[model samples]
Target: MTIHHHPSNETLATYAAGTLDLGRRLVVASHLDRCDACRKAVRGFEQVAGTMLEDLPPTTMSADALARTLARIDGLGADESRRASFREDFEPGLPACLRRYELGRWRWIGPGVEMRSIVVPGANDVRVFLLKGAPGTRLPQHSHSGTELTLILDGAYAHEGGRFGAGDFEEADESVEHRPIVSDDEACICLVALEGRLKLSGFMGALLNPFVRL
Candidate 1:
């Protein structure tokens, strides 16, 4: 699939520096898995970061630091292998970045739309979820309070900006408002990370806002 949208350079830099929150990092990683261009961009940023770190003054390490670090790496590898096996047994078709997290049950949010919340580890304010909308589903018009990141996993959707198909990454801020409609040819499945609450528009949006918990 062709990826027409990508995270901004600033976003990629932050991601490479490991400064992004978990939810946003996962969204960017999902995009990187499908977009080779973004993957290369991230690698470039990582190289720059490594160069900067090399110039920093050296710090002394504990006598057993090397042993402890190696043990930690081994532990992490084992844990990651178990998680991958678990994901393969359950949600086998998800993006690799999402496979590490536990997925909640799919819940119907509208006539043709369903949502499944991802259980992120640790305390986080960002909300991450997968939304599946059948063909012809039109979401309510809304604007974000902070930032919202969306990565299309399957099918396509269109809004004021343009049509987003598989591997498209979209970033929305508080200034943008839109109503996305799933393409009639197939259902649309997307992973989303929202930093703040949605400000639904119109009277119908107000009525449904309470029920449309993201």
Candidate 2:
């Protein structure tokens, strides 16, 4: 289908600079693989940045200047051939960068909330989950502690923010509290990457709190 929503200019710049985290960079790479528009956009930004650097006043540099500049330039070199590499590395059903992830056994955590983790290679404690809105359900009013990236795998959901259907991705700032309601007749499935512990509220929260350790 289509590439997910184009990353913001800031993200593209970060990708070009090689400063974003690996997980976030992988997501951006995923988009760059399918969207040539974004590819050109990133290239344009890099080119503009390079041009600006050349226009800057010349300054005497220490011995490390060459090495540092080379390191910076290395990340900006997304040659035409890189598209194929990115596509191959992130094929459907399996991400080459995350091939070592062995999904932990999935089980129900609540009436609609269920989770299974795919461990990040070398970082076993760190994992991601595939969650679904069982039947006609949704998430409770909750806020994630860290950056929460939700990619819709199936169906749709509506929240105060708006409606998001299959294939849509929403990045939630930790400050936003949401109660996403399943809009489709079926279910909404999502991939979520979480770091800090999830703080639960409302009823059954205490009951659920003691039930799982993820």
Compute each candidate's TM-score over C-alphas.
0.87, 0.67
Angstrom error of the Cα, residue 22, model 2: value is 1.7
Which stretch of 10 consecutive residues in model 2 shows the poorest summed lDDT? 80-89
Error of 1 at 112 (Å): 1.9
The lDDT for every candidate, in the order shown, is 0.82, 0.62
Task: Write the residue-wise lDDT of candidate 1 on 13-32 in tens digits.
Answer: 88877778878888887787
Candidate 2, 1-214: lDDT as tens digits: 5545556787778777667665555445545654687789878887888899899999989999999877665532343234324332232443333343456666788878777665545333334666768756766566667666666656778888777765555766678778788874876766665555566656655666777554
Candidate that scores best on TM-score: 1
- Candidate 1 lDDT at 177 equals 96
| Residue 49 lDDT (model 2) | 82
